[model samples]
Each structure stands twice: as C-alpha cells, then as structure tokens.
Target chain A: MVRGMAFDTSRRQVVKGFACLGIGATLPLCCGGTWIQAVAAESFTLTEIVDGVHVFTGANELMNEANHGAICNLGIVIGDDAVAVIDSGGSIVEAGAFLAAIRGITDKPIRYLVNTHMHPDHIFGNAVFRDAGATLIGHRNLPRALAARGEFYLRSYRNQIGATLMKGVEIIAPTMLITDRQELDLGGRKIELRAWKPAHTDNDLTVFDPATQTLFAGDLVFLEHLPTLDGSLLGWLGQMDELAAIKAAHVVPGHGTAPASWPQALQPQRHYFEALARDLRKAIEDGTPLAEAVGTAASSARSDWQLFDEYNERNATAAYAELEWE
Target chain B: MKAVRQDRRPMAGTASKMAAALALAACICAMPSLAYSQAANAPSEKIWNELKTDVFEDRTIQSDTGLIRIEAPKRAQDAALVPVDIFIDPAKFPGGIKSLTLIVDVNPSPVAATFQFGENSGVTHLSTRLRVDDYSYLRAIAETANGELHMAQTYVKASGGCSAPAVKNQDEANRTMGQMKLRQFAEQDSQTGKGRELQLMIRHPNNSGLQKDPLTQYFIPPHFIHKLSVSQDDRPILSMEGGISISEDPNFRFDYTPDGNGEIRVEAVDTDGKVFRDQWPLEAAGL
Candidate 1:
C-alpha cells in the first residue's frame, strides 16, 4: 500500500490553494516558477557535502518557535532520473521549505521520502512530501510507533513550538516498510536503508549512500546533541558495536553536524551511555530509589554535551526504568 | 493460606475506580472540560477539587498530616514514565495502614492504583512509575485501619503522559508480557529488622486506551495489570488494583519484612484475564 504515489489531487490542490493564499499578492509576477525555492533557499541552505548529495544541518536546539522545529539533519541525494530525501523536518513550514530547497537543487521527482525514526523532529514534514508524489518509506515498526505516539506528539508539541507553526501538520505513516534492509535506487544511484534493533528509538532506520560512503545515522550516532532514549538502554548499548561496524567514510547524524567521520563520531554518545548505565547500575545495586539516583546518574558526562541539563535527568529516568529490569 | 489462589473479579474498590475512569473520560469528552482548563496552571485546584469527590466519595481527607509523603519531579523529563515515591511513617499510625491510593488528578483516569496492605506486612515505603497526563497533583492517600485518610501530594509539571503510547518495542513487549521477576536486597544496616527491600518487575503494556489506531480509527482497548497480589511464605504482604496510569512493564519497589523461611510469591491478572504467577525462595533475612 504505497500511498505516496497515489497523488491525491484534491489534497494537493487544497495545499496549493493555501500556499497561494499565503503569498497571493505577488503571485502574478512569480506564480508557478522557482519563486518558492528562491525564497526557501534564502533562509534554509542545503550544503553540498559530496558530488550530488546535500545536507541541511539544523540548529542544535530544541524545537521552538524561533527554530521553526528544524532541529534534525535532513539529506537529499540527486540521481540521474529521480531524487531521494532522508527526512521531512519538524513542521509543515520546515518541510515546505525543505521541498523547495530540493526543487532548488533538482526538479527530479522525489522518488522516496525516508524517515529515520518516529520522532516528530524528523517526520513532521511528511505531509508535504506525500503531496509531492514521493513514496514514504520507513521501518516496519514505524507505522505502529507513529500510530501510538503521533497524536501525543501533535498535542504536546503544540505547546512546545506553538500552534501557529503546527497548523497543517499531519502524522503520515510510511507505506513502504523496510523490515531488515532495502536498497532504494534513485535512477542510477543506489542508497541503502537498514532498520536496527531498538536503540535511540524502536523504529530507527538509517540511510547510506554507497557512492558517497555517507551514512545517515538517524539519532543512532548523536554528536553534540544529547541522545534521548525512547527505546531500550541495554538494547542500545548492546548494538553499539554493530552500529559502529557500518563502513561509512562520513556520517550525517540525526541531530549533529553533517559529514561527521564514521565510527569515531560514536565515541561521545558511547561514553555518555556507559556513564549513565554505570551510575544507574550502581544505584540499583545500592538500593537507591530512582527519584534520588537520576538526579546525578550521568553527571560525569554533563559538560560534554549540549542540552545536558534539559535531557540528562530524563534520559537517566528512561535508562533507570530499562536497566532495573536487567 | 499456603499456595492460595483466588480468581477475583473486579472488586468493589476496583469497580468504583473504573467508574471514576469512565466519569473522567466523559468529563474530557464534554466541551471545555476540566482536564483541558486545568492545563494552564500547574497545581490545578479545580481538577483536584472535582477529582477528590469522584475518587474518595465525600470522605474527609487530611492533607500535610506528616503520615505520608509523595515525591515526583517538578517537570518530568518523560511524561510516559515519571518516577513517584510514596513514603509512609508507621509510627504515626501504629495500627498500620489498611490501604493506600495513588491519584494523578489531571489524568484521564485519576485513580492510578490502590494497594491494600497485608496485616503485619511491615511495608512502609513504596516507589513506582506513573504516566502523568498533565501538570497535576500526584497524591498518595493512606487509610488507617480505623478508616481515617491521611494525604500527601506534590505537583508534577508534565503533560501527555497517559496517552504517550505503549513501549517502543511493541513486538518484544507483547512477547515478554506476564513474565515476572523479583530482586531481593540485603537489609539496610540503618533500618535493622525493619525489613529488606524487594523490587518486583512484571512485563505488561499497561496501555492508557487513549491511543487511537490510525487504520481502525478507534482506540486500542486498554490492556493492563488490574489485579496483583504479592506474598511471602504464602502470607499476604500487599495487593493492588491498578489501572492504565501504571507504566509499561509495571514495576514496584517497596520495603517489606520477609519471613525467615519459605518462598516469596506473586500473582498478577491483566484486563484480558491472563493470569501469571511466580515465586522465589526467600533469602536469609540479613544475608
């Protein structure tokens, strides 16, 4: 059921109607041309890392009105005939801007819109791609994850990022599911998609461009941004070796700078995970309550990462719940 | 009472809790409901005011009585799993508390869980995780053997907890459902003879029933551990009537005086009528 190719004419027309309504005054001069892309590229720049691959590194900040919820890395791969997108960004505004940026690069029909996980920061712009006739692709478990958390994300993020930006946002589940591994061909170029065990998230999927030796390690290999765990701690720590084993010359992490050197970029997160686990294990062994232990569980790694104060205790809380079962 | 097995239906207390949940659900569906209006203020006095009558039914509740204390994060990192600690001082009521009720006032089902303590169980402190749906009061109401209620509460600033969805690994969660484990801790030297601590972990989804299936356009029915009883040497220690507010993979850690010999037993029942039982030989009291 790859609904992405269905091309819902009515919805696209409605979306077009809304877009025109936003900038109706200037439509006569630049209505159907590259006006949108020209405007989009003015604010959002997609840096070309390799030959045809471009990366847009978002701000290292939480999703707020100021950032427009563009807090995750987004990628675009241009091929001979079609193009492939890594993520949709965090809002309709972000996604629209991203699609315009892609249009700025190439008019190739976006053959696939790949979601790395179920986090809103990565997939909120899906509706825009769905309108662009790009087939949505994700992990097999992604639909279930989206179904479960989609409403909550919509409701909660409205408060975090404000309602004006949340308008027209829809939680669109992927139709093409990658159970284990799948190679998507954008005309002549082939990109690999691999779904991993529950690590940073249960439905984590990574994209690798073989031609460029670049891996889009979605939230799996965070650098500067503190990794938030919505999945199993033990599962994540257990699979670090396997994740690091992926032979990628450069990596585009979900929340960090683009083109990070592979395997080496994993060190900081690995250290943070080990520190948090060590502290939590000691606390559990010592009979210290979760409420008391999480206050200082990963304090050793606090100064190393950004947003440590905002997410460390929360990560410690999640880790404590998972580790206590071990 | 060794190896006692009771197939209990929803008891009166459980039924009222369900009623409270249904009433709260109705209140939420009604336009401009209390749940929505209370979100602006952290310590929503209106929600607690309405929830008190629904849960306790006009009973006099004494707050800040020094008998019980509830601790929770001021702003939860993860709304789906907020750690809550409830400590009870036995000296305040030497007769012992008959039961304790946990309530998250702004949650869809405010009566999170109610536990009935066994006679001489020596249980004084209870710690568990809850899904706080909004910025609301997390309350622990302890009923003395004489039926007097003493309350302690803290305001937790969190939202979207009850409807935060089930575990991320849904397949693994289902596969491991109903599995139980109990970890025993050596007696603390400071609280000698007060009893050792035990952490009981059970694998259950404990879904809040608020998540809607996008394909079906209806809520996935709530599935959770509704009845749980833990005992030592077949003597009752504590039992609980729980609801969806309990986190996935329900866990409870508490201090209990273990009998010198025999095994510790646990039996839990979910909404689907699945029964799971496990027991472990009690270790030496101090070793």
Candidate 2:
C-alpha cells in the first residue's frame, strides 16, 4: 500500500518536471544529453534482467549520492525452487528490504547467500539471511575477513544506527567455502560460482547463471560509475580481461545500471586500472613522491571517466602505494 | 588519589557491623557496573549492579608509585578498536610482573586479555589492540611486588574499530603480515637521557566479529591477533595479550630507555593461530 503512494508521488514529480521542460524547449539544450538519453529519466527501478533474476538499482540517493562512496551494485538472483541472494546491502535494514522485495516476487525460500568479497558495505547484512535459515557462502578467505572485524562492526552498528534495529544480527561465517569454482543447481537453474583470485579483493566470487546467460559480476565491473580498487590495480585489470571473455547476454555490476554488453561496462574499469598502473609504475621509476604522483596520475585519467573528479586522486594514491613494491 | 580514599569511607561505614558484612557479601557477589549509563540506562544499570556484585565490590585497589599505568586515547575517532598501552613500574615490582589484565567494564567480554610476561622482560611496557564497546573507563591491573593486584585506569571515547574493514585486499594484507616498521618521532630534551618514544607498526587483520562479506550477504568469521612479544637484542622487553579491541594493522607508540646498540624483534600470534615475526634495528638518539 505504501509502495503505491510512493509510486504515485514519483509519477506526479516526473510529470511536473516534463511540463516545465516543455516551456524551455526553445532554449538551446544546455545539458549534454537529451531527456530521452538520461538513464535516470528512463524510470528503470528494479527489473528482472532475466527469468527469475531481479536487479534493484538501489536509489541513487541510497547509492553514490553522498559521503557513502560507490563500490558495488547490490543484486538478488532467484532460482526456480529457491532464491540465491547476491551482495547484501550495507546494513541489516537494507538487507531486510531486499528480502522483502524478493518475497514480493516469489515465495521461494532464500537457500543460498553468496558474498563476492569482504568489503563491509557488501557483507554487513549477513545476519539477516542467517536468521532466515539461509546458508551463507563465500570464498575461503571470508571467514578470516569477518572474524577480523566482526565485533567492531557490531559495536559500530549499535552506536551509529541503534541497537534495536540491529537486534539478533549475528556475524555468521559462510557455511560453504569455495576455493576455485563451485557449481550448484537450484532445481533446473544452473549457477556457477567462480572465485577469481587477487582481484578487487583477495577472494572475489562471480556468479554466472547459465539459464539466463547472465553474469553477476561483483566489484569486477562498474558501469557508468567509479570503481574502488581495494586490491592490486594490476590484478584487477587482469581479472577484467577474464570477465570480458565471458559471453553473457547481460552483466550485472556490483554498482550502476545493468550492462547491455560486457565490453562496454568492463572495458572502462580495465582502462582506468591500466592508466593507474602505468602512471604509478612511471612515478616509481622516477622516484616521485606519493603526493606528487597522485596529482599527475589523477589528472591523466580525469577525462576518461565520469566520477574521476571524486575518486581519481584517492585511487591514484592507492594505486601508487599498491604497485610501488610490485 | 585522595578522592578515591574519600569515596571508600562511605563503603567502610556500610561494612562496619552485621550490615557491613552483608553489604560486603552483596558487593562481592554482584557484578561489575556497565560503563555506559547514558544509552541503555535501565539495562546497563542492571548489568552495572550485577557487575558491582560480581566484581569490583569491596575490592580495594592500591595505587602504588608505579605498579600499573594505563595509556589510552582521551577521545577516539573510531570505537571498534582502541590502542591501549600498559607500563609496569620496575621499582614497584622488581621480579618482572607475572601477568597483566585489562578490564573494559562495558565491553561484551569485560576481561579483554591477560598476558604473562617472562622474567627476562625488562621494564614491562606492553601495547595491544582492543575493542571498546562504548565510551567507558578502561582499567589495567597488574600482579605485583607483594603478590597483590595494583591497578590504573583511563577513560576512552567510543570507537567503531572492529566494523571498519581492512583497508587493503585480503591477499595483499596477507603478504604483508609480520612486516614491522619502526618510526622514531622527535624526542624531547631531558638531562638524564632516559625516555625515548618510538612508534611500531605491525600488519595484521585483527578481525573483530562484526563485519560481513560484501558479495555473499553473510557475516565474516572473526579472527584477530591475540598475542605480541617484543624483544631487544634477542632479549624480551615486552609482551602483550590482545582482544577484539586491537586495531587492524596496529600502530602503537611507547616510551623506553634503549640499551646501547640492539636489534628489536617482534612476534605476533593471531587468534587463528597464525604467527608472524619481524625485526627492527635500534638506533641511539638523544631524548
């Protein structure tokens, strides 16, 4: 019922904006893209990328809108008999909302919850699935990842978000740990879980759905958004090559809109990484200080990406430090 | 010091006769008080009363000259893990204190860690990482000279250290474990040339039990370094037992009197039983 109200309000706002824009149609279009060209105006909220595969492009405000930097797009993939949720949001509340969305689609129980990496924003919602009797799955390094920072997260969540909302949130380790690749069939739907090594994170898992010809690429691919490289710049760039090789019809990134093709979405991140690696290597060879390298590296890549002004410098600094010894 | 004495006088009256003995029993039987009375007032009060009975009741902690000294952040920017430094006065307990214990009264596990230092250890100065559940007073108790416990305390603001993810990738972080670096800050001038401050950086995940896997939609298991040993010229100087409060890739600074030319060795053991060791060469400098 509340959803209907929200949709009605949003429709009215869209109509009002269109009415005002019609009066300014005579003015030379100041914006680069047409109203039709703007992806935000397309009204693509949550949609099924394929059969039983739903992707919620979290509200832009909920995503890369503020201090909470963009890392990955959260996703949910439901199989025939049971649902396999991918990349739980940053908090239990967010995860609960995602679970509710899943319930709205089907009555299938969430049997498997897979984490692509150990970043806090992606995994802080594990407790919600564990409470619902879903078996958590991730790479072998995930247990160590959570164990290292679990208590601290619980305390922080209680302090920042309030303990009541986070009640019964348990930091449960993944029951199933994948080493290289693991394949599971949820009824007739085949899901392939592949652990890509030393990319994005120490252990990054990419879920490929054969039935839908769709690949749920975690942080490995960022479409129309800045990519955060917590792993080696060189390693992530190499992984991008492997991801591009995957012939999937649709690619769901950890963040941003669903990619129509792998090359379009994955190539930019690879290019950014390549650019970062090249600059960092040159700086190291020249014995340039880290601070100086940051400016030179970011300025070089500024024109290539959209959110370069926001994260390029930091990315350059991280890339420099990461590749310095290598 | 005098105020601590005055505060005990009223307790003495409550323990004078039959009522005193009963009160003493209640105090000993009850639990130590929970530190945060501001947030969870009712429950924390209950927990505090329970703790007051279970621990810290009728217990007299002597503040000797230098038995135990606790150093912690006056205001922490992050609450998950806070660095805590403990120094035992050499004069007060000459036989090299046996064990040191930390009690963060409000944390989920109040007894953070207990370390048993060897006899060869000189002027015990141990630093460890810990998780502070809230803004609370942290107590460091040392077993000393007369086989009695001496304690010192300092208040630390709330920090979310545990929830904070390790900055680097898991593999990159793994490759750098056991790598130790010592940075010496500018020393202050003193006539005797006694104290020198040095910052030590040790790379370890120090995972607290609160973070989740980004893609899996599940919680990551908790694993953290539990013990640290520092030695100079192959001789033990300090050893620390850690808890969830230790920050990831712990950076700690301590003041010490260096002995001429010696190499410092540091060994750390994580809760997952992973051990790492590194060495740093000591350089002589004026304080």
**Number of the top-ranking candidate, with lDDT as the measure:** 1
Instruction: Say what the RMSD of model 2 is.
Output: 14.3
lDDT of 1 by residue, A167-278 (tens): 6677889999999999987877788999999988889999988776788998888889988888878888899999889977878898887778778998999999999999
lDDT of candidate 2 over A127-209, digit per residue (tens): 76776678889988777656655655665555554554444455667879999989877776768999887777666888988
TM-score of each: 0.87, 0.53
* TM-scores computed on chain B for all candidates: 0.84, 0.64
Give the top-scoring candidate (TM-score).
1
Q: Give the clashing residue pairs of candidate 1, or none.
A: none
Give the poorly placed runs of model 1, Cα more than 4 Å off. Answer: A1-42, B1-43, B159-165, B190-194, B214-216
TM-score of chain A of each: 0.88, 0.77
Q: How much DockQ does model 1 earn?
A: 0.43
Highest DockQ: give the candidate number: 1
State residue B180's C-alpha deviation in candidate 2, in Å: 4.7
